[model samples]
Target: MSDYLVRALAFEGSVRAFAVRTTDTVGEAQRRHGTWPTASAALGRSMTAAVMIGAMLKGEDKLTVKVEGNGPIGPMIIDSNAKGEVRGYVTNPQTHFDLNELGKLDVRRAVGTEGALTIVKDLGLRDFFTGQVPIVSGEIAEDFTYYFAASEQVPSSVGLGVLVNPDNTILAAGGFIIQLMPGTDDETITIIEEHLSKMEPVSKMIERGLTPEELLFEILGKENVQLLDTMPVGFECNCSKDRFGSAIISLGESEIRDMIAEDGGAEAHCHFCMEKYNYSVEELESFIDEINS
Candidate 1:
C-alpha cells in the first residue's frame, strides 16, 4: 500500500496519537542515497518519525531534525512540512554493520549515542522555535521520546523502526507517536503505558501489512480511539533547475567567468535527492550578464 499516516485522539481527547506506514517512502530514500543496510535503517527511522511530527504542524509551518552523532553514519538531517513533504540525507550513507544481539540492524552502532537530536521549527514567526536534547538511545524512537519530554516538556512515547533487506534495500519502515495531553488522569496514563509496553515493533507491523489506523488501534485500543484526519506521506524534495540557476547567479560575475573559462560548463548536485543540474558555458555567461546588470 502507499505510504500514509493517521492522526487520532483517544479517550475523548485525553490522548493524542499518530501512526505511519512508510515502507515505500523510506525505500525511495534508500535507493536515492544508496544507503547500506544499517545506514538505511537509521535514516529511514528518522524520516518516518519526522513525517509524523510534521503532521503536527499547521499550514505552511515546517520543521527540521538534525541527528548529530559520533557513529560511522555521521550526522543525519531531515526537513518536513505540514503538507506531508519530507527530504533528508545522511552525511555518510555507505555505513553498515552486522545485526546486533537482537538479530536486527545495528542502528545504534551506526548512530552513536554521544550526541544530540536538535529540532528547529519554523512557525511562520520572526524567530524560529528550537529544541535540543541529548540522545537517550541512538535507536531513534527513544531519542525522540526523550526530546519531547526534555526539550518540549511534553510527555510522549515514540516507537520507530525500519527493517533492511539482505540486498541493502528497505524491507519495512514505520513509527508511532503517542502524547499525553494535560489533565490526563493517573489511571489513564497507567493503562496507556501498559499497552505501549506490550506492543510489537512498528516496522514489524508494517511488514505484516498493517495500516496506520490499525497500528493506533493496537496501541490505544479499538474502543478508546477517536479517529482524526489522515494524510498521505512520501519522499519529496523541493530542488529545481530554476533554483539552481538562481544559485549560479548568486555566485557573482567573477565566479561565473571562472567557470566559463576553466570548465566550459558547471554541474550542481542536490544532496537531498541526488539530482544534478548542468549549465552550459552559454548559460553561465547569461548569468554573469544578469549579475552584472
Candidate 2:
C-alpha cells in the first residue's frame, strides 16, 4: 500500500497526535541506500518521525533533522516539508550488527548513546528556528521525545519503528507522535501515558495493515480523536543535474574549468537518495558561459 500520514487532535484538542504508515516509503530508501538491517532501522525510524514532524509546518516551510551519534553509523541527515515529502541518508548505510538484548535491531549500538539531535526549521521570510538536544537514546524515538521536551519544551511521546526483512528490505515502518498541549488536564495525561505503555510497537501496527487513523484510534481512543486531514507521504529528492551544475558554478569558473581538465566530466552524488548527476564536458562549458554572462 502507499504511504500516508494523518494529523489529528484528541482529548478535546488538549492533545495533538500524528501517525503515518511508511512501508513503501522506507522500502524505497533501503533499496536506494542498500542499508543494512540496523542502518535501515535507524534511517527508517528517523525518516518516519521526521515526516510526521514535517506535517507540523505550513506551506513552503521545511525542517531538517540531524542525528549526530557517536557510533559506527555516523551522522544521519533528513529533510522534510509540509508537503509530506522527505528524504534522508545515514553516513554509513551499510552499518549493521547482531540484534541487541531485546532481539531487535541493534539501533542503539549502530546509533550510539551519545551525540545530539538538532533541528533547523526554515520558516521562510528569513525566519528560522533551531533546536538541539543531547541524544537521550540512539533508538531514534527516545531521542526525539527528549528533543521535543528539552528543545521545544513540549511533552511528547514518540514511537518509531522499522522492521527489516531478512533480505535487508523494509518489512514495515511507521510511527506516531502524541503531544500534550498546554493546559492538558492530569487525567488526560495519565490516560495517554497508560495507553502508550501497554500498546504494541508502532511497527507491528503497520505490519498488521493498520491505517494511520486506526493507529491514532488505538492510541487516543476513537471517540476522543478528531480526524483532521491526511496527506500522502513518500521518498522524494529535489536534486537535479541543473541544481548540481549551479552549485558547481558557484565554485567559480576556475573550479568548473578544473573539473573539465582533470576529468572528462563532473559527477555529483546526492547523499539523500543516492542519485548521481553527471555533467558532461559540454554541460560544464555551458555553465561557464552562464557564469561569465
Candidate 3:
C-alpha cells in the first residue's frame, strides 16, 4: 500500500501526536538514489520525521530539512508540504556501516556525532521561519527532538526508524512524534513515559503491519488517545525539465553561448531526484533567443 500519515491528539488535546508509514515512500527513494543500508536508514528516518513536520503546515506552506553531520553519509536534504508529499536525497547515497550493538543499522556512525540539523519554513507573504540546532545524536530522531526543544521550544518525543533488506531495499520505515502541550498533568507525562519505554521500536511496529492509528494506540494507549484525520503520504519530487531549463536560462545569454560553443549542449541535473535534463544545441539557442526577447 502507499504510504500515509495521521495527525491526532491524545490526553484530551494536551498532547499532539503524528505517525506515518513510509515503506513505499522510502523504498522509492532508495531505488532512485541507490542508497546503501545505512544511508537508507539515515535518509528514511529524516524523511519520516519531515512528513510529520509538514503535517503541521497549511495550504501552500512548506518546509525543508537539512541534516548536515560529520559522518560518512554527509548532508541529507528533505522537502515536504501540508499535502503529505516528501522528497529527499543524501550527499553520499552509498555510505554504509555494520550494525550497531543493538543489531540495527549504525545510523549514528553513518550520520556522525557533530554538525547541525536546520529547518526552514516558507510560510508565504515573506513570513519565514528558520531554526538550527546542534546535532546531539546522529540518530536522526534525537537530533530532531533536540531541535524541537531547543529551537521551537516544543517538548516532543520523536522516534524514527528504518529497516533494510539484505539487498539494501527498505523493509520498513516509519515514525511517531508526540508533543506535550502546556498544562499537561504530571500523571499524563509519566503514563506516556511508561508506554514509550515498554513499546517496541517504531520500525518493528510498522513491519508487523500496524496502521498509523494503531501505532498511536501503542504509543499513547487506546484509552487516552483521540484519532484525528489522516493524510496520504508519498515520495514526490517537484523537479522538472522546464524548471531546470528555466534555471539554465537564468544563467544568461552569454553563459548559454559558452555551453553551445564548448560542450555543444548543456545538461542539468536535480539533486533531489537525480533526474538529468539534456538540452540539445537547438534548445540552448532557443533559450538564448528567449532571453534576448
Model 3 misplaced regions, further than 4 Å: none
TM-score for candidate 2: 0.98
Question: lDDT score, residue 8, model 2?
Answer: 95
- State candidate 3's TM-score: 0.99
Better of 2 and 3 by TM-score: 3
lDDT of 2 by residue, 1-293 (tens): 78999999999999999999999999999999999999999999999999999999999999999999999999999999999999999999999999888889999999999899999999996778999999888999999999999988999999999999988889999999999999999999888888888999999999999999999999888999999999999999999988887799999999889999999889999989888988899999999999989
Q: Residue 60 of candidate 1: its Cα lDDT? A: 97
TM-score of each: 0.98, 0.98, 0.99
How do all the candidates rank in terms of lDDT, highest first?
A: 3, 2, 1
lDDT of 3 at 44: 97
User: Which lDDT tens digits does candidate 1 get at residues 1-293?
Assistant: 99899999998899999999988888999999999988898999999999999999999999999999889899999999998888899999999887899988899999998899999999999999999999877989889999999988889999998988878788888999999999999988988889888988888899999999999999889999999889999999999999999998988888888998899999999999999999998889888788778
**lDDT for each residue of candidate 3 in 41-90, tens digit (9 for 90 to 100):** 99999999999999999999999999999998999999999999999999
- Among these predictions, the greatest lDDT belongs to 3
The global C-alpha lDDT for each of the candidates, from Candidate 1 onward, is 0.92, 0.94, 0.94
- In terms of lDDT, model 2 sits at 0.94
Over 4 Å off, model 2: none
